[model samples]
Each structure stands twice: as structure tokens, then as C-alpha cells.
Target: MSSSTELTEKKVFLLKSLDGVIFEVEESVAVQLEVIRELIEGDCARPFISLYNVTSEILALVIEYCKHHAETCSGGTSATIADEDLKTFDNEFMNVDENILLELCSAADYLDIKSLFELTCRTLASLIKDRTIIEVRKMFNVENDFSVVEEKAVRKEFAWAFK
Candidate 1:
């Protein structure tokens, strides 16, 4: 029942990152973030969405990812694209340094991008799999809070699994 003009109208949203950088993104892309979708659904008239905890660098990466997902799932001929292509895109999307990956993970979690959050977490887990706690601590710059005795006790308990 809507007129063609209404259907043809585009919806864009302005998002402000932690560093005061603003990005103009399409509604389709914004909706991919559950937090943003809730905000938009709650008030479509709201012009600006602010992500206070997300740095501009991480926010930019998230925006790029959401836009790619939105376009890939746009429900047209491209919707029938091969799954392998999507996998390739995902692989390439996750190719980044550890710091950027961690930042992206935090951004994804804050934005409630389930797919992105899971992907980033999985990528991080992969990096730590089979590595020693010392290596993990070094990689993530985590301080060893456990004393030598506690560390040895826990390691002794899990010695069977460490083989």
C-alpha cells in the first residue's frame, strides 16, 4: 500500500565512535548490530548513535564487516552466491594483528554483532590453542597473577592433559 517514493527512500544513520569520529552507514548495515538494531527500532527518528567504548579504529572495522554482511545478504541475485566465497571473505576479514583482533573482538561484543563476536573470539582462541600459559600471557600482555607454588600445583593437577 506504500507509494514508490516511500519504498525508494534510503535510511542512513550517523554513528559516533569513542574518538569523536562519525560514520554514515546504511540502515541495512546498522541493523546487523543487535545493539544498534534495538536502538533504531526503539526510535527510528533518532539521528545519531554513539558508541562510547568503541575506538574509532575498531568501530571502522566493525562498520566495514557489517556493511559487507548486509550487502552479501541483501536478498537478490547476490544472495545466491557460493558459500565458499563467504568463507573466503571471512578468512580475509580476520587477517589482522593481535591488537587489532582484540580491539575488534571488544567492539563486536559491545555492538552485539553475534557473528562477528563469535568469529573474533574463535580467531583469538585459535591463536592460543596448545600454547603455554606463559606464551598466552606474553601474547596478551597479561600479568602472571598466580604465585609459583599455585602455578605449579595447577600444572601438576593437569599434567595428564598437558601430554
Candidate 2:
């Protein structure tokens, strides 16, 4: 409990992504992910929380989001970063390609980062909205893996919704 010892134990944690990349993250940023927060609260947080399902690229993006949010919400930067500014940041953060967006969505879900998950989902939904099935597939670079007949049948089943 010495002041020097307390100062040495900085409020930070570590996360290892699926690609074996290790990230040193502040506790404020780490808490943005519900799963990480749970681990900390349960006293089960290790020196490094291994995210076996998240890639380094997506994890980096998630960390950036958490860091920004953590700083803004801590009231330390609210005077400079308002909620509207956060919304703008979220909008721009989701402007990546479909593949990256998909990865972000999956990572957000795995990390239980609610805001990020919702933002990615909304970005995905908006991409498909008011677009034809073919356009939607093209936008997502989705190959028709299904056989021709199967594709026709499934498309027919939900034909009304598409129209």
C-alpha cells in the first residue's frame, strides 16, 4: 500500500488478439467491453485477456473506439468531445469496406461492446436498405455459394419482403 507501489500498479490491462497481437489498454478503455469488465470485477482478469475470436485489425479498431469513449465519458474530455462529436466519430468509424465491417461486427459481438455492435449492425442494415437482393449481394461481395435452384427457392420464399 505504499504510494510508490500504488503508482506502479497502473490502471491498465492487456489483451491478446487472435493473431497473437498483444495490446496494452487502460482499464477505462478495457471496461468498455462488458466481457472485460466482468472479468475485472470477478477478479479473474489476467495479465492478458486472450480474444481468440477477434483479429488484430478488428481488435485495433475496437480499442480505438473504447479509448475514445473511455476518455469522453470520464468527464476529462467532455468539454472538448461532446456526444454529437462521438456520433460523428461512430459514423466515420463504420465507413470501412464490407469485409472489415463484418469483422468489426463479429468482434464487437464477441467482446460484448454494445455500442460498437449496434453501430456495425446499423451500418450493415443501411447498406442493404432500399437495395435489391442482387445489389445487396454485390455490395457485400457475397458470392452465390448456393446452387442455382436453391438460390431461386430461398429468394422466392422471401420474395414479398424483397419487393
Candidate 3:
């Protein structure tokens, strides 16, 4: 029922985040996501993509990340830059406190960017590698919501690691 030209031409997409902020992004970028692309390519008249779990702050970060990668992929940077320089830039860009890093990881996962997800996971793993359970929980703001006995039991179970 649809012409091929309509499919190929750029379409504007409306993405609504959890905090009620609406973002208008290009169809190309939206299509980079399989679910969104399928929805767009479908014959639905009103395709309002609602991201119900992502906060406004997280959405902003995700948009910034996508825009940055899009620019990089579109060759906005100088070709003369050395690989080392690029690596340094990536390192610096990813460097953040644990809370922001966790949020970034969640955002990446929600956005379905596997590479960014993996990178953030690896970064968190690296940060936690040498930290104690208490330190890890503190860093992540994970409440010791468990009962005292349960908390002690878990701590005892990993006593060797803690010691």
C-alpha cells in the first residue's frame, strides 16, 4: 500500500521521554534502532515513540552521545588527527563519576547501542575490580535495603573477598 519513495525519504520522528520532554530526531538515526525502525517502516499513521523509562537527564545524555557518534561517523573530525588522540578523546569522554557512569550505562542499554553499553559495562567493571562491596554499594547509592541479618549473611559469604 506504500510507495518505495516514501520509505526512502527522510521522515521526522517524535520521541517522548519519561519526564515529558519530546525530542525530534531524523528518521535515519531513529531507524538505526531496530524496534523504532520497524515501527516507522510500518503503516501506522501516528507513530509516537514513547520512552517511558528514561528520565529527561538521561535522555539528554543519550542524545548527546548519539549526536557525538553521528558527527564522528559523518567525518566531522579532522582526518589528520592521530589514533592516539582519538583514543585519548574517547577516554576523556567516558571518564565520569560512578553514578553518572551507571546512568550512562542504563541510557546506552535503553538506546540499544551495544558498543556503548559494552564500553560502559567494562568501565564499571574496571572501577569495581579493586573495590570492596561496601565501596561498590556506596558508589552506586545502592541502599542496604536488606535486613540486618541478610546483610550480615551476604557480607559473611563474601568475607574472604572483603578481607
Candidate 1: Cα lDDT at 35: 82
Tens digits of per-residue lDDT, candidate 2, 86-106, equal: 888888888898889988988
TM-score, one value per model:
0.89, 0.79, 0.69
Query: Sort by TM-score, best first: what order?
Result: 1, 2, 3
Across residues 8-104, which tens digit of lDDT does each residue of candidate 3 receive?
A: 8866788888989988777646655544556777845155688777787777776666555555666655755544454565577678777788988
Order the candidate numbers by lDDT, best to worst.
Answer: 1, 2, 3
Off by over 4 Å in 2: 1-9, 76-81, 138-163
* Alpha-carbon shift of residue 93 in model 2 (angstroms): 1.0
Supply the global lDDT for candidate 2: 0.85
Residue pairs in steric clash, candidate 1? none
lDDT per residue (tens digit) for residues 29-147 in model 1: 88888887878887753668888999888888898888877767764645447355566788999999998999899888988999999999999999889898789998899899899
Q: lDDT per prediction?
A: 0.85, 0.85, 0.72
Any idea what lDDT model 1 has?
A: 0.85
lDDT (0-100) at residue 152 of candidate 3? 88
Candidate maximizing TM-score:
1
In model 1, state the lDDT of residue 28.
91
Backbone clashes in model 3, listed as residue pairs: none
- The list of candidate 3 runs beyond 4 A from truth reads 1-10, 43-47, 76-89, 143-163
- Write down the worst ten-residue block by lDDT for model 3: 79-88
In angstroms, the error of model 1 at 112 is 0.3
